[model samples]
Target: MSGPPPAAVTVHAPLRRRVTVQGVVQGVGFRPYVHALATALDLSGNVTNTPEGVVVEVEGDPAAVARFCDRIAVDAPPLARVDSVHHQEVPATGDSAFTILASRADGPTRALIPPDTATCAACLGELADPRDRRHRHPFVTCTHCGPRFTIVTGLPYDRDQTTMAGFPMCAGCAREYTDPADRRFHAQPVACPDCGPRLALLVRRADEAGQPSPVTDGDPIAAARRLLAGGAVLAVKGLGGYHLACDATDPAAVERLRHRKARGDKPFAVMAASVEDIEPLVRLDPEERALLTATTRPIVLLRRRTDGPTVPGGLRPAEGVAPGSPDFGIMLPYTPVHHLLFGLPGDPEGPRLLVMTSGNLSGEPIVTDDAEALERLAHLADAWLTHDRPIHVPCDDSVVRVCDGRPLLVRRARGYAPLPLPLPLEVRPALAVGGDLKNAFCLGAGRRAWLSAHIGDMDDLATQRAFERAVAQLESITPVRPRLLAADRHPAYRSARWAVRNAAGRPVVRVQHHHAHVAAAMAEHGLDGSVPVLGVAFDGTG
Candidate 1:
């Protein structure tokens, strides 16, 4: 208490206010955190994540009201990302204890879904503690990370709305999840090895005849690591989809993976066990290392190490590992599975490093289904490290780099895409059709713009399906019946075609590809075309 209340102080009557928070405020454990805070402060109100942002209505004692707004942000949940909040006073009606309300349509423009974050320091410490049940467990996760947009199927991110819906939580984990003081409180993805999703290995049943099928039932992650130890190739499912994995040190394994995947030219990314392991394979300046290790865990393109062998035809069939390029895309393991595969320092059968590449038949969307990955990647892979967790959204790994010392996003998936960007211009709540390659769409309202996770090249039918599903899902959360729609000028753009096909009830704006890009940059930098500035528009075929 900051001194007892003044004896003569007449506490003003409590007022009611409706608050709207914009930015990446959904699917990151925000509503529950607010509920907890409000309950503790004895406030009566509710908060919900609408397509626009989080909408809140609160009424309580004057001091509690101040604390409600002020402390909520400071003590915000670890995974929740708050950008800007707007609140307005309204009529007050008597109410009970504050609670989290189900998300409803508040305005146009979808709230940005926070990207998957890395495990928190606290959770990691617990994972490494032998006294803990999940000590050194590979699948350990908390509110900070594990999965978010990648695993969510709908809004109001609850366990039932996630891939974890199938496996019911064990009694102990469930208890911790409900305890207010516990870190796992209301944690949607919480589970122990006993009640959590299981792992299984998929191998080609008839080798040359059929697709891959799981041979072993339990612990596919651990089994896959054992196979990798023997220098075998295994296709593993990741946050977005499947990734082809092999021992990094085994040149034979790497080369084999390339030949099987029919990759003629395109560099395969290497996942060093740790930041220290990366130094030998590539040169990492202090800044580069910092970006690589950030919570985003983006694949970073770094100049290759002078010590490693140059691209050679004789090298493991990674034939196209580098085509028309000089940089190598490298990243540290972002998921708990990747962490477990490259076992911590003391674990036996620990792999010092591994080669992890997208699971696909070159030029295809990453694989998500166990049967499909086996059938599709059979030759390219020796075995499958499959899990029971179903992927709701298919996002690829996001890649980035420092060009001229500024961060440049390359792939824009896993931990970046789907997170809304702040825009300078507030359009009539609309959808900004993204480009054809690494295709991602943006929906917005007010100053906030939500970008969908990377949708991959529009050429593949699978990618097209993903694009359609993504659009519907975003529309559900950001509830926008855009009075006006926007698309690219290019006639061949699948996105443009989609816009044309879907514009049954609205006005359509066909913006040139580069124009939208420039406009987006301008919006982000707060530029209002008062002064002329140099701009470059590049298109090879146009």
Candidate 2:
């Protein structure tokens, strides 16, 4: 009736477009996604990773090309934040297939790196499945989740630029890494038990003159669990830095660690396997639960429960863990190592709750160097559960609390550093060295500002050196080149002194402490200062 399906008419002529997508696109499965998208649309072209961003060329029907451009940013991967997408029409290539090309490092690095994310659901399932090849693998990861900002040393987000460079992928891993259909395609940190980081348990031996020695017998995770159950303190290396962990239910262990670390009644954060495990100790509102389970995996502070279910076998959090505090800071396992430390299914029972705190003296930066951790934590931990992967940046755990059903950031580091905060107005490229107490600096250019991770106090030389390193690293990854420096007006403040020393001929702007606080509040609220507003600033120094 339709003239025998007359000659398969083309609704639109073939067209091509070159597309550029910016923001957190690299190291998060953007290329494979593009391949799948183009294949579905019957388009021909290629996708490539560049320091500037992702570049894609698609030649297909004009309507299909328009759809691709529209959906490129809208249907981006969960971890990939597409800030901008620009495309231009070009001559059609008349090709038949879409392909992913190797990463090119031939442009200025403008792509933003994503923060480290917790293990995704897929990887977790494989970890617990006995039939899976990655079962019980400590460093199991995929494109959807795993280390990002901490492991990355350069742009273009390739494996060779990460700490995993030394551990080449096995044939099995290589297959997954290359297969676009696989979840791990282009995952920079992808690995398996055959070729990846390995864990070792080092215990202090009396015969070895109190020096820690490797326990080559049995699984390191199992050995570490046994030590924890026996009221031992452990120095456990994590994605960011070292954490001093002990059984939270053991009153003796908690007191011992407090005394050793010189923590005087300051509350310690605790890590549990799930929300159910911590419900008896803290009140879990819906918002608090969400924050605890979020991919960021920050320590959520919750109100303490006065009367709750009884936990057997002395499994309750010790009073010494958070004495005189009405809230308890709790977080779930964010890494495979932490999950194994708490024991997986069919594994020997271990401590369900642990008091996890920064592995450092009372007021020093979190220890990242392996040898330094062993030396500095000798008196703090009875055993060392560490790996070979180097931590390029020392990021402490982030802390959050829900106030009025809204989350408030108490300390932003591991999960939320180097991410730009959109400013209400543009400003010249500048650096602001914060006060000496908290010592977090900011780098700003245009309408974005990036706050560095918590850099510790500036009272000691070690922290000063750490500050310099952090500044250098942050500058390398960001586009900000400070043309102006800002510091507090306190003449003798160590932070101010450091800013002046490193101004390098740039003018230093000294602002009053309280005035800076009020201005920051205004800026955070997106106030353009066109209207007068009353503000009250309160702080110990102010």
Instruction: Name the top TM-score candidate.
Output: 2
Candidate 2, 1-542: lDDT as tens digits: 45665577657878999999999898889999999899888889999988889999999888888899989998989998888999998878788889888889887778888899999999999999999999999999999888999998987889998999999999999999999899998889999999999998988875546567899989999899988999999999998899999999999999999999999999999998778788777788999999999889999999988896345555798889999999999999999999989988998788888999999886788999989998999999899999999999889999999988998888888878768888888889999998888678899999998988888888977788989999998888888889999999999899899999999999999999988888877877798688998989888683
Candidate 2, residue 316: Cα displacement in angstroms equals 0.9
Per-residue C-alpha lDDT of model 1 across residues 313-395, encoded as one tens digit per residue? 22221324554566778788787777777775567755665677889865566788766876777778888877888887777
- Using all chains and alpha carbons, the TM-scores for the candidates as numbered come to 0.85, 0.96
Give residue 469's lDDT in candidate 2 (0 to 100): 93
* Model 2 error, position 334 (Å): 0.3
Local distance difference test values of all predictions, in order: 0.74, 0.90
Q: Which candidate leads the pack in lDDT?
A: 2
